[model samples]
Target: MIQQGDAIPSVAVKLVNKSGVIDGDSATIFGDGRVILFTVPGAFTPTCHNNHLPGYVSAGEALRTKGVNRIICMTVNDHHVVSAWADASEALGVVEFIADGNATLTKALGLDKDMSGGGMGTRAIRSALVIKDGIVEAVFTEDQPGQVTSSGAPAIVEFLESMPS
Candidate 1:
């Protein structure tokens, strides 16, 4: 799995927004600032839609105040699904959504899980990463698929609060 000090992989991703979809590179997107990149198993899943994402939406301001230049929520779904989820969550302006349609980034970071048993096929494990200038500063991965313990927004806020200023 990716760890502190490892650089984000340079992979192509789709940036989905209300305007439309845009092709983007992971390295360029996360390379220049303090970023909070959180991943869900899949977009609009029960746990993800009800619990995980809402935390980040509510905590967006707190994270930004702590120097997060960007707040991103990524999933192993296509641009259309991600865009709809972003709209439903009402997080368009507050949280940016990225579509890892091919699970390229997930596999590259070693965070991919075979969710075929659940009929979801390959999916990203629930996790969060704090990166600065493209290098990982912290990694919080949930122990189980349904539980959001270490990778939740509150945990991230606490982690940032404990950082040396």
Candidate 2:
């Protein structure tokens, strides 16, 4: 898995918003400035709906206050699904929803966790990364998919606060 200080993989990813969809390279996204990027297994899933996504949604401005240029949430879902989920979750403008349909960024970062045995197919491990200028500054991932201790918003916020200004 990609670790702290490693440069993010140069891969393409798609994101959807009220304005429509846009595609960009991962390096371009992270290399621009500081970003708080979080991944979910699927949109509207139990934990992701109630907590994971909501956490970042609520923390969006705060993260920005701490020097984060963007707050992004991604999943192995399509543009339509992700866009709808963001609208339904009230995270539309707060947290940018990205579609990692083929696990492109997930696999490149080595954070892809298999869920096919349970019929969910392949998905990203529930995790968060702090990237600055295309380099990973910190990574937070839980031991299990359902648990969110290490990977949750609070953990990420605290980590962000601790970074040198």
Candidate 3:
């Protein structure tokens, strides 16, 4: 998996917005800015729906106040699923959702998680990356699925608080 200070792969990701769809890459979307890229194994899953997504949504402003330019929630699901989940969660404006349908970026970063036995197929593991200017500043990943500790919004908030102002 990618580590702190590692330059994030400039992998292509389909960014879905209410306005329309746009082709984006990490180096560009997160370019010249501080960003929080949080990933969930699957959208609408119990833990992700109840905690991960909402946590970031609730902490969006605080994270930006601390210098984060964009906060994104991503998964290996398609755009339709992501859109519906975002709508359901009311996370439209607060957090952008990226559809990595093929787990392109996830695999590129070496964070792919196999859930095929569980019938979900390949997905990104639960992880978060604090990237500044396209370089990872901090990385947090949970060892077990359905557990959001180091990668939760509050944890990211604390991580930001610990950074030099």
Candidate 4:
């Protein structure tokens, strides 16, 4: 699994926004400035749609005040689904959505979880990373698939609050 100080892998990803989908890479997305990248098992999943994502959406400004440049919500689904989720969640302007359509980025981070038993196929484990200049500064991963204790926005805000400025 990726840890603090590890460089983010260069994997192709699709950035979904109000305009449209744009082809990009992880390096470009996370390499420039402070970023909070949170991953969900799938788009529109109950916990993700209701709890995990809404936390970030509500805390977007607070995160930015703490020096985060961009907040990215990623899922192992296609851009279309991700885009729709973004719109449905009212997160279009607040959080950027990324589509790991092939799970390339998820696998590279060693955060892939097998949900085939649930008929969801391979998906990303619920996790969050604080990255600065492409290097991981902190990682928060949930112990259970359905819980969002450590990876939630409140935890992240607390973590940032503890950091020496």
Candidate 5:
């Protein structure tokens, strides 16, 4: 898996917004400023829906207060599903949702967790990445799937606060 100080991959994907969708590369997404990007295995899953994304959504303003340029939520879901999930949860205004449908970015980062036995197929491990000026500043990946600790939003914010300014 990717670690702190490693540069992000050049995988391209689409961001789904209420108004429309924007195509972007991971590097370009974090180019202008610092970004806190979190990934879950899939969209609308129990842990993600009930806890992961909500934690980030609630911490949106606080993350921005700490100089985070964007709060992004990524999943191996299609654009329409991602859009519907964000809209249904009322998370459209708080978070920018990205559809990594092809798993190109996930594989490049070595975060492709296997869940074929459980029928989940290949998915991303729960992880949060802090990027500044297009480079990774920190990474908080759960030791395994089904765990939420440093990968959650509050912990990520604290991690960012602990970094040198």
Candidate 6:
């Protein structure tokens, strides 16, 4: 797994946001300011919907006040599903839902995996990264399948607070 101070993969992908699709640089999108980028196995799944995303939304204000420029929730799902999920959670006002339909970003990050047993196909592991000026400041990744590890939003917030400001 990636770790603090690692240079994030300089990659780009097509992502769908509320504003529509965009060709975004993984680095630039997280550059210039502090960013919290999180990945989930799939969208609308039990843990992802009820736990993962909601926690981030609930922690949005605190994260921003701590210098987080953006909180991105990415999944190996399409635009429509991402849009609906964000809307249903009322998270459109708090988080940015990004569709990684082709796993382009996931693959580039070397976080792609086959989750066929769960019927999720290829997806990224549940993970979180704190980036500052395009450089990784921290990373929390699940140890293996079916584990949450230290990747939760609240954990990420705690990690950020522990950092030297």
- For TM-score, the strongest prediction is 4
Model 4 lDDT per residue over 1-165, tens place: 999999999998999876779999899889999999999999999999999999999999999999999999999999989988988899988899999988999999999999999999999999999999999999999997689999999999999999999
TM-score of each: 0.97, 0.95, 0.96, 0.98, 0.94, 0.90
Candidate 5 matches the true fold with a TM-score of 0.94
Q: Between prediction 1 and prediction 6, which has the larger lDDT? A: 1
Least well predicted 10-residue stretch by lDDT in candidate 6: 8-17
Model 2 TM-score (2 dp): 0.95
Clashing pairs in 5: none
Error of 3 at 19 (Å): 2.7
Position 18, candidate 6: lDDT: 67
Ranking by lDDT: 4, 1, 3, 2, 5, 6
The TM-score measured for candidate 6 stands at 0.90
Worst 10 residues of 4 by lDDT: 16-25
Off by over 4 Å in 4: none
The global C-alpha lDDT for each of the candidates, from Candidate 1 onward, is 0.91, 0.86, 0.89, 0.94, 0.85, 0.81
How does model 6 fare in lDDT? 0.81
Model 3: colliding residue pairs: none
lDDT of 3: 0.89
lDDT of 3 by residue, 14-103 (tens): 887666467888678877789899999988999999999999999999998999988988899988888888889998788998989999
lDDT value, candidate 2, whole model: 0.86
| Tens digit per residue, CA lDDT, model 6, 22-92 | 77877767777888889999888888888888899999999998899888888989878887777888887
Can you give the lDDT of residue 55 in candidate 4? 98
lDDT of 5 by residue, 1-165 (tens): 788788887778898766668898877877779888899998999999999999998999999889998888889888888888888878877789889887888898888877788898888889998898878888888885677888998898898788777
Clashing pairs for model 4 are none
Candidate 5 local distance difference test against the native: 0.85
